[model samples]
Target chain A: MHTRTIEILVGLFLIAGVVAALALAINVSGLTGSNNGSYKVYAHFENIGGLTKKAEVTLAGVQIGTVTQISIDADLLVAKVEMEIFSEVNYLSIDSSVQILTAGLLGGKYIGLSVGAEDEVLVEGSIIEDSQSALVLEELIGKFLFDKVSE
Target chain B: MNISNKIMDGIASMGRGLLDNLAGLGRASMVLVHALFVWPQPKTSFSLVVKQLYNVGVKSLLIIVVSGLFIGMVLGLQGYTILVDFGSEQSVGQMVALSLVRELAPVVTALLFAGRAGSALTAEIGLMKATEQLASLEMIGVDPLRRIVAPRLWAGFISMPILSMIFAIVGVYGGALVSIEWLGVFSGSYWSVMQGAVDFYDDILNGVIKAVVFGFAITWIAVYQGLESVPTSEGISQSTTRTVVYSSLIILALDFVLTALMFGDV
Candidate 1:
């Protein structure tokens, strides 16, 4: 009887470890976005440079949302990115810049939000005005080569 | 003349000792093969395996978790210090996750298992031998090898991977705590960077395979030492010490080989 009790306890401990590992895996994978008190926003860019769905959206280094969708504009040949911004970050102005940025030198792409001096706060379903795409390494290299060749 | 004779004698004894140890290993392997393949009763082996699993895996949980956490914290702190100079502190997540999943988790988990459970198993078996319990079992026509050693060996094989997984997972969290909360990194960055950087097959699955291999080495060494140890108190102590030393050396060496094979091209 005593050994059986001990076995049960050990089994419970092992189960807890597994559950914690699973929870951590899910959290780190970013499967569940910032669903806590968030609203939608959108932006347009020339090139996203391998940005995928569910990329983080940050305002002043704080995560405020995620990129929910990416689509190409039919006429302007621009990438239209849809974002979900949490309502807690309500201080963003209508003219705030939305820029695609790499987290580190070779890290994943995310959205960086820069504040503007305008007084009117951004509303739901609004578009950020100043949008910047990621800097493409190949484009820069090609441009450098073209300049060098011309010279 | 006397001094030369002593030197010659010492060399001769050393050779004899080496031969004796090799012979012991041969006998132990025979026992292992029988224990593993020649199943007498499946129910008894299964129950014994569970008991050994509890002893080796569950009892060592606290130490594994604590060490895993500290290892991760150190990785985060040190990684940040180095990476911030390059303006890449954000990549600490990748550094920590990759380090833990690919190398530290399996290596550290096996080391701890050897030190704690491996040493204990060795001592326990050595004690049983010293007390002549094994002889008694043999006289009773019971195959002590199957009854005693096999389940423990199989248990270690199973436990090492699970423990290493838990270690890596816990270590990642420890890294996140330091990188995110203490260092003021974005929480999202801590996890997202890791998820993007680590591959399921290359980083995680390979780490698991390494864990299984380390487990087999450690357990086999411990059990072999215990069973073959000279039937004395000094012998038991010596075997226990040898188990720790040999298992650790084997774990580190195997890590290098596995890493070369798994990630040599990349």
Candidate 2:
């Protein structure tokens, strides 16, 4: 092969590798440019247990949105979570119940949605009623210990 | 000889063969390191290395792209089913990214590199030796190690990591295409969840490091096996096959060792 051709080939190879690496690195970590067609919903919990921002909100085991914000209700002294559900899921009923459920034995916490028997549809910024707090492992262990001690 | 004597003789020969393999491993490692020290001693080495970079890295692009896309798509589909059970199918990006960066990219790229570039290197050097071209160069006082082996070895060492990274990057895009476009996942959740979970230094850098190490090991075996083989057509062919076999085994074993050291809890 000619020296010039070899140089061009090497340059192309290097460029391809660099671009791919950059793409891969970008894909793995940093700000997600995934803000496409998502709308917000609200749910309140008494104890969120290790739940943080960007958790999942699902209906019937299917992901419909993300937990975009978390804050405190000053009067209720409880946690409030804001979710960004996709616009396509237009019929999440207002009477739907949200629960803070853990995945597997040691997986992350997410909000699970179960639709209630109601004809009303939830528009943007609507609040989900009948939400439950996260099932804290520490609390479960403590309660178990107390029950054993008393027995 | 009696049956008992024959059994004893078989055991003795096995022990001797084991010793020979150990000795060969020691000798091959020494020669590889020696070539590394002599790598920069030649004026013509740069152009040759570039040629090898094109030969190995550029030529392998299509294979890498095709396989990377398929691997990513498969992971996305499979991970969706499992993650859906956990109500976290949106995190399919995390599953694909972590799996590709930490394992599949390096290991698969290295295996392919061995079969493509590594086998060819062995065949090329073996042919040159079989035809007495190496002997002619040595007769004129030109060192074959500097002229022939060093450039190819170094080129492979550099190219492996780059190819692996490209595979990983392309793979992530493939996964995104499947999970987001095909499966109707929320587009934003895919990339963002991946970003939230994967670590840069812990996962990506370690994968690149593994590729570089695998490159050095595979290329060293290829070049050494070819350069030192008996100067015959059959001998050359046998050594080329051995290059692929040995590189595959060593790549897998070294991956285990490196993973234990780099990602182990200790």
lDDT of 2 by residue, B38-121 (tens): 737455777778888888888888898899999999999999988888777877988999899999999999999999999999
Kindly list the per-residue Cα lDDT of model 1 for residues B123-174, writing each as its tens digit. Answer: 9999999999999999999878888998899889988888888889888889
In terms of docking quality, model 2 is acceptable
> Residue A15 error for model 2, in Å?
1.8
Can you give the DockQ of every candidate in the order shown? 0.23, 0.36
Error of 1 at A146 (Å): 7.7
Pairs with backbone N, CA or C atoms under 3 Å apart (clashes), candidate 1: none
**TM-score of the second chain in each model?**
0.93, 0.93
Query: Of the candidates shown, which would achieve the greatest TM-score relative to the real structure?
Result: 1
What does candidate 1's lDDT look like per residue over A1-151, in tens digits?
3679667866876686577446545644434443668788889999999898778888787778778799998988899999988788898888899888887675678889998999998877898769998899999999999999999
